[model samples]
Target: MTSLSKGDKAPEFHGLNQNNETISLETFKGKKIILYFYPKDNTPGCTAESCNLNDNYQAWLAKGYEVVGVSPDSVASHKKFADKFQFGFNLIADTEKEILQAYGVWGEKSMYGKKYMGVMRTTFVINESGIIEDIFEKVDTKNHTDQIIKALDIK
Candidate 1:
């Protein structure tokens, strides 16, 4: 679990998006950010979560929020995934796990009696000034937007 909590200063990060464009916290300095970290690209849970956010892209934008995804997947994989889903948001390719480590989302995991290091699916809702407003450690993949909206009481 992440040591980060609401009201803490969000860690600054910079990574390449699917388009290979450099993006950083500074890029969205004046906007609320929904920063999500997932395990991989094209996986079932990740896909569902990503698509849910994509489907509500317009609503998020209208609500003054920007969605960004981060995964250990490479830039090429992110490009393919985003292109296939036609996502309007940015998917950061954190191939080096720099951003993941900064957010404390990259860590050990156990599945089927096997232990491995991987991403812990998590989301951070950061306010305009780079303060974390909410942290979602247990995400509802298929209905994530609703989860965030309900948690934040967004009208």
Candidate 2:
């Protein structure tokens, strides 16, 4: 798997959003993108990060950017998570894990010495030109969306 990093052309794919509508990076061409890959939906830290972004969504819009959350979850689960948390952005249902793997966020993770494979909780910031400008390989779930906005200076 090619490690997604700064200067890499953001891997593009067409997938279903929370509503089961198909979308791709091509759809958001000419705009900055926040492609956040978390482990799951409706979980404690994931929900908080998503909700934080939703709370500060207008600021992000004013700065002209789009947020897309991806995980191995299904569309139905994403819909429920979005509805429950009023997530204003698109939650991608990457059931095949293609997107996650493409971004190199799917790998072995160990928790308490029990090694297991799972989503690596990573985030990528693709610029309007479709170049990956920033990559947060290990993200702090608490208030992490703010970190993205700050790192990108989305004022």
Candidate 3:
């Protein structure tokens, strides 16, 4: 799969959120979207990343941005995770791997000599006009909010 680049146009996607509400990329037009894809829900890295974003979510909105987390987990799983963590944003359930494949965030991952297919902890910042403004592939979930804020040029 071709890795998504800085200028690559983010693929369009229509999926259900934790509430089972159908959402499409078009619905978020004219807004800054922080699209972060993680491997799973409730896991250490994923939890830390989501919590950090939740912790600093106001800063992002003040800069005219919205966040939409995506993962291969089911909507129920996403709901439990979000409810448990008190997240303030939508979690797109990409269980079919459609969005994951299109974004190139889903692929082979290695852990202790075992290879498995999963999300790569990649994030893309899409501008209001739908162009990808930046990408952070080397995500450190513990300090991800700072990284995203810096990438978006927010003070």
Looking at model 3, report the run of 10 residues with the lowest lDDT sum.
1-10
Cα lDDT, model 3, residue 68: 93
Best prediction by lDDT: 1
TM-score of each: 0.99, 0.93, 0.95
**How many steric overlaps are in each model, in order?**
0, 0, 0
Put down candidate 1 lDDT per residue, 65-112, tens digits, no spaces. Answer: 999999999999999999999999999999889999999999999999
Best by TM-score: 1
| Global local distance difference test of model 1 | 0.97
Off by over 4 Å in 3: none
Q: Residue-wise lDDT of candidate 2 within 1-155, one digit each (tens)? A: 23876899999877999999998999999998888888899899888878887887777778887888999999999999999988899999999999888888889888899999899888888889999999987676777767886777755
After TM-score superposition, the amount by which residue 10's alpha carbon in candidate 3 deviates from its true location, in angstroms, is: 1.4
Against the reference, the lDDT scores of all candidates come to 0.97, 0.86, 0.89
Q: What is the C-alpha RMSD of each candidate to the true structure, in Å?
A: 0.4, 1.6, 1.2
